[model samples]
Target: MLVAGTTRTAEIEGISAAGADSDLLVHTPSADAEILTYGEPIRAPVVPVSPSGCPTPAVVTRAVRELIGLDVTVVDGGLAEPTGAPTVTVGARPGDDVREQDPVSTAPGVLAAAREFGRAVPDDEVYLAETIPGGTTTAFGVLRALGETPTVSSSLPENPLELKQEVVRDGLTASSLEPGDAAGDPADALRRMGDPVLATITGLLVGLVEGDTAVTLAGGTQLLAAAALARHAGVETTLRLATTSFVAGDESVDLETAARALNVDLTVTDPGFENRDHPAMDAYVAGEAKEGVGMGGALALADAAGVPMEDVRERIVTVYDRLLDGRDPAEPQP
Candidate 1:
């Protein structure tokens, strides 16, 4: 099962290049979760795309899930808009700017509730993913608070490293935290610098591990931040971090190094999008919208299931074309 968590942090200007319209960035997560669950966005008029017209990674995720028959659960970690897709509510409000104090004041309660939900999941192995806009900034903040100097991944081809650094620096100062201040207290980091999605995933990881459920964290830096938090909280269980080669190949951030620092096993999958004729696939090759909505993990699972990379790329094109036409290609035209 893939659990997708949505947050409002994506609304931060110049922070995320996830959506074409800056105003719709908050809805990207909802729209992503919707597409992952239903093959097309139900609330938004169209599927989320980058400013460059590159499709959201959720398209890739949806195709993989269809081919591999993976189930998905959306979590309302904090949503500005209610998703038409079914979701699990974890008692969290939408996160505020991390530069503000108490960005996720309800984080403790959210963590506890999500832990219960994680324990109740029947799946022995769960794949945790996220869809927050500006997530890399929050991930950076959380990691810094936990004493790690992380180069977080971005959805854009060129990561806005300077802007993210400024944001994290201000956030830490605003919260009166120095690097590693929350090292011994992971929840404290969530209360100040983290988003609800981070808290939810960390809690879920702990609960899932305690329940003896094998788990794979499916994303790049965001999942790595959650893993770092879980480790600080004393979760010694072996965990796997899975992502697409786009993220691994990104020179803007070092995912492999962070994974090693966190001591989590890392798996990177090349979905063979580069060879596709589709513009959406080409966008991935060009380094736009690198990874999110469990795209990387979906690809890894597809590989493990022996699904050919060519087949996966073909399905991605099918899904993208379906979204483009606003209907499945398999459906008869009027």
Candidate 2:
């Protein structure tokens, strides 16, 4: 079984008012870290810089490659900054800021493309992951549209509940969509307040199910919304969700409750980064960059494959050290 995946950059990530700094501070380096690690050495990997110093995708991806020996298939759903990795371009326009306008206009086309890709996947089973910035807020919006009031998790330790709620409120108002209005119509809900990744992930799940392939959505709240959309679209396939203990530990949101509500089997991976010596790993314990680039899912898959948890921790720390080698701890460079 191979781990197949997609990547998208949403401009809703750029809205400072949304309280998501996924794209603002580090130039959204997770995209670079994700695919570049599978290719040549990234002479300059994009490292996340925040008050707590967020965890980089390179560590997580490095573990995936070393443990599973599968590379991610990048999909250009939409990007504010094009990833250094080669990508399949399925969308031309980046998502608009949901607070100002409908973020996703190409939902239908993206969904179609995702379904086609899913049908062609050579792997009998795939661990599907995504790298979309600001996806949680869009997840919150989509969940609300689906008649579910969900408190979604965030990369930042101090969850900006008020800011996310504010943005979702403005987005719903701009679209003239009241809560639960689009519950029966997943596409309409996506069109109203979702993003490219949500559409693509939902479509991928549906398509993979059609192909008789078992799929695991590897992320946090965003995957919950995608699974909800799949079920709403009449997909009865039992899908699994894998995320980190950090996300489950987030006091800001109840991911377990949300997953149970959606009828998605949830698995939480404990990488034990808290006991690691690396600062970046320490940041994860502190609640910065809790989950992204399918870190949690990859860990869960590695565990399922019988890779020792200690080995997983060692690889992540080694990668984190190499990526941050010789960099100034005081100044952050893009």
Query: For this target, which candidate reaches the highest TM-score against the unseen true structure?
Result: 1
Clashes of each: 1, 0
Q: Evaluate residue 79 in candidate 1 and report its C-alpha lDDT on the 0 to 100 scale.
A: 73
Measured against the true structure, the TM-scores of the candidates, in listed sequence, are 0.94, 0.87
Model 1 regions more than 4 Å off: 1-8, 326-334
| lDDT scores in order | 0.83, 0.68
Worst lDDT window (10 residues) for model 1? 325-334
Query: Which lDDT tens digits does candidate 1 get at residues 103-201?
Result: 999889988888888888788788999888788888888888988777688988889888888888999999999999999678889889888888888
Q: Please give the lDDT score for candidate 2.
A: 0.68
lDDT per residue for candidate 2 within 58-97, as digits (tens), equals 4675676777786666666555554566566555246666
Q: Given candidate 2, what's the lDDT at residue 267?
A: 97
